[model samples]
Target: MTDPVHIVCPHCEAVNRLARERLNDTPVCGKCAKELFVGAPIDVNTARFNKHIERNDIPVLVDFWAEWCGPCKMMAPAYLQAARRLEPRVRLLKVDTEHLQDLAARYNIRSIPTLALFRNGREVARQPGAMDVNGIVSWVDALMRHA
Candidate 1:
């Protein structure tokens, strides 16, 4: 039997086991009938953010931003584009700094737009500033390679 790998369903928050070979392919959740990797940023509140970080076996790239921040607005589309490209390899997540002030404070996020990469529920890298699609992809690729 192949070793089981844990993956959290972005649609329904259900944890499921999948073979390592299936990581690059399309994955469907047994409970929710949704694709496990949808190539979109998943909006997560404080509680759900903690849960996802703790439970997911894949690397998570979280965008910490606010609704009113100009830089955040400018980078939104780029972030989404990067998410679409990086799907199945990295789980993209978004945390609204306005709604989750405590979380923002916990992470010591003083900037309006910050990107943090987490693996195994630990922060491996972070950057502050708005990045274009190419920049985002390059950053993640570099980080993952180094990791």
Candidate 2:
């Protein structure tokens, strides 16, 4: 078995300790008993976003977006497709800038469709703009390799 990793529950926002080997086995949360990785971009408010970014051992890809932004809406489907390919390797998150402006300002998100990659509670790389599924996948893959 590998080391235990801290994985914040996507359902209840409770942090769970999980073995690295079992991350792909459809593990359920210890507190809420809900599936941990649901294979989609989780819509996170401030509290959940903080917990996720700080607690998760795996890398987190956050799409900082707003409902009123055209590029953000245009990239929504691509983000979802990227989500399917990313997890349970990465945690894909959608943060609405309009709802959580503090998070937006904290992350220095000047653009609507900014994609920030975080690991161990620190940002590694950020890309601004809308990218298709393949482009997103390739960008993440390159970053992951370098990281």
Candidate 3:
């Protein structure tokens, strides 16, 4: 069997240890007893963002956006659909740049609708723009394959 991996619960911010293979089996958090993944992006502020990025053994994909951004709004549904496909393997998240300006500045996110991929608590890839579900899936798939 593969090693157990750490997964941060989306519901209650609890950290759970789960077998790597069981990630596809709909695991629940040990603390909150809630399903760890719900097939959608989790909206996080700076504090919660750090916990997920640093504690999750899986990779994370973050959409840095603002409420006023038209492109960000247009891409929201596509991002949610992409999350449905990418979850359990990757933790998908959305951070509002307007509210969490520190996170945006920390990541040097000069544009809204930017996508950042993080692995082992560090950013590994970034894309700036809006994309369809297929494009989002393809981009993440290619990167994860190479990684």
Per-candidate TM equals 0.95, 0.96, 0.99
Q: Indicate the residue-level lDDT of 109 in model 3.
A: 98
Indicate whether candidate 1 or candidate 2 has the larger TM-score: 2
Best by lDDT: 3
Expressed as tens digits, the lDDT of each residue in 39-135 for candidate 2 is: 8999998988988999999999999999999999999999999988988889999999999999998888998899999999999999999999999
Query: Alpha-carbon error at 18 in model 2, in Å?
Result: 1.4
lDDT of 1 by residue, 1-147 (tens): 467678888878888889878887798997998999888899998878987798888899999999999999999999999999988888899999999999899999989799999999999999999999999999999998988
- Estimate candidate 1's alpha-carbon lDDT, on a 0 to 1 scale: 0.91
**Evaluation by lDDT, superior candidate among 1 and 2:** 2
- Report clash pairs, candidate 2: none
Per-residue lDDT of 1-147 in model 3, one digit per residue for the tens?
999899999999999998899999999989989899999999998889999999999999999999999999999999999999998899999999999999999999998899999999999999999999999999999999999
Off by over 4 Å in 1: none
Residue 133 deviation, candidate 3, in Å?
0.4
